[model samples]
Target: MSSNRDDIILNVDKLSKRFGGFAAVTGVDLKVRRGSIHALIGPNGAGKTTCFNLLTKFLQPTSGTIVFDGRDITRLPAAEIAQLGLVRSFQISAVFPRLTVLENVRVAIQRRQRGDSFDFWRSERSLHAYDLEAWERLSEVGLSDYAHVPAGELPYGRKRALEIATTLALDPQMLLLDEPMAGMAHEDVGRISALIRSLSAGRTILMVEHNLSVVAELSDRITVLARGQVLAEGSYDEVSKDPRVIDAYIGVGHG
Candidate 1:
């Protein structure tokens, strides 16, 4: 909890979403402090994903308000929100498979430099201008050794790192990650956990993740949702001890 409200980077007040007559989310209030790693977790059908969609503008809310950096962005378009520095991930993972790791990151940097307008007439020399920054991003994710390898050939975990590098190229202030460690072995999990922690130094990260271990290890704050509403919010230890949160997971058959 931020003593100074001004330090809160993202706030949602009475946020809700409905599908037909079913309310996927109802009056869910959330606050993420600046430079904190916040985790949103819950059983299936708890509306965590719905909340994510609302934040990213993939789904419009039935009623509520969202404020990013003190600015009301409840109705702003997704692209406009991303342009304002709230870019999402996975959009980067879609990087061209045939492209080498360096080329893939360079493509992302290119997109950051030149919006969506693909000026085919530009010379190759102009594109190389972004290579230096691309290498820096790859280095940040520990991909410098495989710079010339095709992105498609990267190991499962490295592929995830490459995706992260591409996302970092956008230089977003706040990042929204949806299950960043969805499919990975144990070793990869540790590696990515470290990578995510390192990335949190100067930025706020709000993620909806199911891996409780990963969430417990990295999250500075945690919000537990159930039945389309927030059931608990606190530090990982505090939330883990909450009977309601424990029951929600147990009740859902979540191992």
Candidate 2:
């Protein structure tokens, strides 16, 4: 446990989730410090996504509590949680495929800024300002050149970048990424990795990733899950060296 109490940004106490007869997560406790990158890793069926769903209010936990930024938010709705500056990116791309790349991001900004719906007649000027801001965000993710193109027209890698740009437009204090590199090519992986690294400065990040190399490179701390429980929690070096972890990986064949 980190004694630096000042840095604690998110705390989970005795969190558990169940789906009728099945317990997907059990008695998991976690602490994520401000501005730190934390990785959650495990083999398939390890309950990593279940835990994330519970924390982000995509699913209700059967028991336990979640505190974010000093407030208890265990029962908050997903929208409310997002309003509190906790944002998540899905394993699959979640972008408006029919909307222009810039328009997709503009809607995200408008939501965060509490602007009116994307209406041409009611708030054209404000919407245009959001468009400019969206372009700026697109630039941040290196997607500015595609601003006017329909999002579905972009390559898969670029679509993912646009999703990140949309998330950025939300101005989150903490970001949760689930399998961000799942379907990308090696070059795309490197590009997204660099983008993640660059974005981590001054922000808290929690990611669930299957790639051990990426976890090792990006995480300040790592928590391992197995069979609906926490198996280990420590630095990458410590957890990787643990005999149990080695055995688990060997049994799962590098999942």
Candidate 3:
């Protein structure tokens, strides 16, 4: 909570998005500090995913600006933005089911390390190095035991962990996770939460999560959204106690 504006990692100013007449997000502003876990939470249809899409450049904003590490990146492509160290994991699992767990991560590492090269034989040493790094990342995420197994053969929860490990191999300075806990059992949730906490030790994270307990446990700040706008922004307790947020939840039958 100390003054760390100088450590600000992401700045979103008046970001808005619309689908024709439907406003998905309007005038949402946020500042994510370096190494902080910021959670965005709201009821269903709260525009959380739309906002995430806009920030990650999957969808262009109808208005406003997004600045990452002092660069105005609102107009950048998703791949371009990712190269700038901002990476996002989708709400749905994005993994190569047929590839081995280690191979999936190895591919991601190689892609990030060498860009898009068609010649696999051009850099055998580099490829091997990335494979080793991927194994290490898999170990970090507690998926080492499954490294040689086919990704599709792993349990749902382990597949999710593998996805996170693959993302980590990209060396993102800031990570955007959309409901990383979705579709998981309690044990899986706990495992993924621990992985998230460990991964965020020295990087910035902005996550859209419905699990309030996970948000409370991991977030340093919370942003509540409703009807395409930010209803409240504060620490978990402060946002939870806000009357507007309460009303928003009640209106959505989630209170």
The model with the greatest lDDT is 1
- Each model's lDDT comes to 0.90, 0.86, 0.86
State the lDDT at 141 in candidate 2. 89
Judged by lDDT against the true structure, how good is candidate 1? 0.90
Per-residue error at 179 for model 3, in Å? 0.2
lDDT assessment of candidate 3: 0.86
Please give the range of 10 consecutive residues that has the lowest summed lDDT in model 3.
Answer: 89-98
- What's model 3's lDDT at 201? 84
lDDT of 1 by residue, 1-255 (tens): 447988899999999998999999999999999999999999988998899999989999999999999999999988889888887788545467899999999888877778887565789898889999999999898999999999889999999999888888898999898889888899999999999999998989999898999999999999999999999999999999999988989999443
| Per-model TM-score on C-alpha atoms | 0.97, 0.94, 0.94
Residue lDDT tens for model 3, 1-255? 576657788999999998888898999998888899999999998899899999998899999999999899999988888889999975224478898888788888877877776356756675666776887898899998898898999998888888888788778999999898988999999999999999998889999998889999999999898888888999999998999998888889542
| Model 2 misplaced stretches (Cα beyond 4 Å) | 91-94, 115-123
